[model samples]
Target: MSELLEQFSAPPLIELESDLEALRKHAQKVLMQHGFPQRKTEAWKYTPIAALERRDWSSDGPDESAARTESIELPFDAHRIPVHNGQIDTSQLNEIDGLHIEPLRAEQIDTSAYVDHDPSDAFAWLNLARLEQGICIRVTHTLERPLALQFSSSDQFKQAAHPRIRIELAEGVEATLFEQHRLHGSGLINLVMDLQLAAGSSLQHLMQRQNDESALIARTEAQLEQAAHYQAYVLDLGGALTRQDLKVHLNESRARTRIHGVAALKDKQLVDYHTAIQHRVGPSHSEEDFRILADNHSMGVFNGRIHMLPGADDSHSDMNTANLLLSEHARINTKPELEIHAEEVTASHGATVGQLEEAARFYLRSRGLNDAEALALLKFGFAAAAFDALESEPLRQWFTDRLKQAL
Candidate 1:
């Protein structure tokens, strides 16, 4: 508690100054009461950020209409929602059927009703405290095309900004989502995503974060109803300090979820990925697969756990993490765990960390490739397996291009 308390000199005083926002007020209260997560907190043990608790933490609020208009858009054509500097720009939003975008107004609804986030989670509390008209995305019906969420940031100060995103899928709705984080500058960005998938609904979300200068801490919470399916594919290639925490709740029977992510890091960058899936009812299942490529003096950490309650019989869960260290100084820490209280459940977990397979490199070299070319080919192939998990071919190509740039 003392270590986290030293990270901040004030308790979100900017949020306390605002009287118009109920969410901010509530979060301000939480911040004042709990402050931040300490080093003793097991969930945050691997991620101890020094900059986040700094006194200069501040945001410039929503971007102007001019800035949103002048900024460049993604190359591919899709239903795009651009959020720059923590402010959503709806000027060019695509009018997709069954999709609704609105401001998270203070007078509209209470934050507690829509969120399952932990109150003690420091960044989540900070995001709620400093949030300004964060976007609410809701899908009511089936959508043929994929939706793109473009989160961009431009801050070079010793400060930071918090962005809150909420996504709700109504019953029987099925949609594909694309989210990309394009960042510039050397500040901090805290983001929270709340996902609600109703009965018979399914969501396939693909995300990529490739910005080296900024420090990013992200959290995701997904709640799945009966027979609902949720799948996420994440690619992290950049950021000075990147940490992502993901939690999934299978509240009903036969719910299915899969979380697969790949991270390629270099230089002195650090990346931490954590996930927890709870099977609250019977016959639910989940699978998690992650791969990390570490080079230079970079570091990567992965921790995944699956929990099955007493009633969660007939469920199955599996997790596997594989890491390749490209440099002697690179480091990777991996932990995969499972807790099953049900007799009929099956669960397994494993992790592996080492250099590239010498046999594979030799095989590639024998096929008319030099040492450098063979290494490049092997690394590309290693990334391709996970990056190609997306159902969309164009999206995979777009991600491949970004990977090339980042790596």
Candidate 2:
């Protein structure tokens, strides 16, 4: 743990301004005090970081000229922001009306809310301490096209990079955010994202990630105000080591959020997802559905938790997770929890893990489809249902096509 910490605490690749330097120093102090999570940590027990600790960060990374890999081609037109090897290429940023992009301000970052005294939040603190690039995006009106954030790493990339991003939506604004990650090589990318939604605002958030070698760790925190609505859809194919934590806070009455995600894993990949939704006021609502399909020697983990605070009367929430193990060696751990402390509040949670039904597979095989084809169709059908609530037809179709290919 100390070795890894030393590597992460090395001098920043880019010099920091005075305000950012102070924040970084504080974050570094807190991180060093807590260190990293160990095997006994409940939240990290199933996910190991031994591989990350073994990495040698002394090698020179990819050449700066070759760091920018080709941008991913999107099915729909969008205002694109391309980040290559953890560096945003400002030249590629598109100018769109009603949208603004600028460097992240030191005042916008507040790490006091994180549980820094514990190792569970060590990665979040590490991100703040070693952040290389930071950006803030603002949306003030309905967007004609989606805003796409494309992140890719080169094949020779071998250094850890930290990037922070914040998205702010003004009151009564409506927009769509499409985030894609394509990672290669054997480096690490630690990311932190903040989402702020004002009153009467609506945001459609979509995420798609595919990686096989690199390690990816990310945390996303969102706060929604009165009458704000936030919908998130995530599709993660697989990776060598992937861990994501998503938390949403409904701070005012009538605020609502829905999350739907699917993780498809194969080979020796590992993917862990932890999501929490908090109803802090009266009459808020939240719904979540996540599915995982693990094949080969892969392992998958999902933990979904919902909390209704004392003053959150009339709040309602539902959470569910379904998992399938496609091979004898594959493993899955899923847990759904609900904590309610308010009167008249309603909450429900469930989780299930099982293999494919033999009877259904036999029926499909008897109908002329080969064994492999039948299996693919069944898996696709099971995973695709999670995205049924997506509003955009094109985006839904895109997700469907990607899922089919992934299977």
Candidate 3:
């Protein structure tokens, strides 16, 4: 942990923003006090940071050649915000109606909730302490097109980059947020995102990520007001090392959220996802579904937790996770938890880890399909159920196509 602290020191990166100096100092203090998570850290025990500690980040700095100038190609039409090597190209930002984009100010960020002396949150604090690029995106009216955030890294990228972003939707606003990550090289991309949904607002969040040798650690925190709706769809194709923590708080009545995710891992890749949904008020709802397919020597982890607070009466939640181990050496760890404290509330959770059924595979093979095709079909059928509830046909098709390609 101390070695990681030394490697992640801020002095050698970029200078801290003057306006956020105090906050950065506070974050640094918290990290210094607790350091990074160790083997005993429950939340991070399955995901090791030893690979990060061994890297020499002394020569990791911004390089002019790392700038990406090509536009990201997407299957759908949308507004794009491109982040190259963890740096946003401000010059490419264009004006869009009903949307306002600006540099994130210190006032827009509050680290009080995550600045505690808990080593499990050390990465969250480290993001604040070493943040180099920050952006604030606000939606004032319903958007006709999805807002896409494309993040990619150059093959030469070997430096760690921390990027922070805040997204807010005004009352009655309806928008779609598309986040795509395609990273390469052996560096680290530690990202933090904050989301705010006002009353009567709706946000559909979609994410697709595929990486090579880079390591990605991302944390997203969302707060939903009265009658707000938030939905998330994720497709992770694995990487060298990946960890994501998503926490959503239903702060007011009638707030609801649904999360669906799939992690397809192969080779020596590893992916870990930790998601928590908090029903803080009455009449809130949440549903989560996650699937993982690990092949070769890959590993996958999924932890989904639902909490119904004391005053969250009439709230309901259902969480489920299904994982498949495709090889003898492949491993998967899945846990689904439900903690209910309120009366008149219903919550159910289930987790299962198993392999493909030989009967089903044999049946598919008997239907004129080869062994590889039958296996791929079986894997796709098991994993595609997570996205069955998606509302958009195009998005559903896109997800299915990507899943097929990944398989």
Residues 211-329, candidate 1, lDDT per residue (tens digit)?
Answer: 76667788888899999999999888857788888889999999999988889989988889988899999899998889899999898899998999989999999888888899999
Query: Measured by TM-score, how close is model 2 to the native structure?
Result: 0.97
lDDT by residue for model 3 over 1-407, one digit each (tens)?
77788778845546656878877888888898999888888999888888898876767455757554545557788888887788876454467778888888999896766738579888999998887778998999898899888888877777788889899999999999999988887788999999999999999999999988888999999999999999999999999999999999999999999999999999999999999899999999999999999999999999898989999999989899999999999999998878888889988888899999999999998989999999999999999998999999988999999999989
Q: Which regions of candidate 2 deviate over 4 angstroms?
A: 11-13, 65-68
Candidate 1, residue 104: lDDT: 59
Between prediction 1 and prediction 2, which has the larger TM-score? 2
> Residue 50 in model 2: shift from native, Å?
1.6
Tens digit of per-residue lDDT, candidate 2, span 102-139 = 88989988675699767898888888889768988889
Q: Could you tell me how far off, in angstroms, the CA of residue 360 lies in candidate 2 after the best superposition?
A: 0.3
Top model number, TM-score: 2
lDDT of 1: 0.76
Local distance difference test, each candidate: 0.76, 0.89, 0.89
Residue range with the least summed lDDT across 10 consecutive positions in model 2 = 87-96
TM-score for each candidate, following the candidate numbering:
0.86, 0.97, 0.96
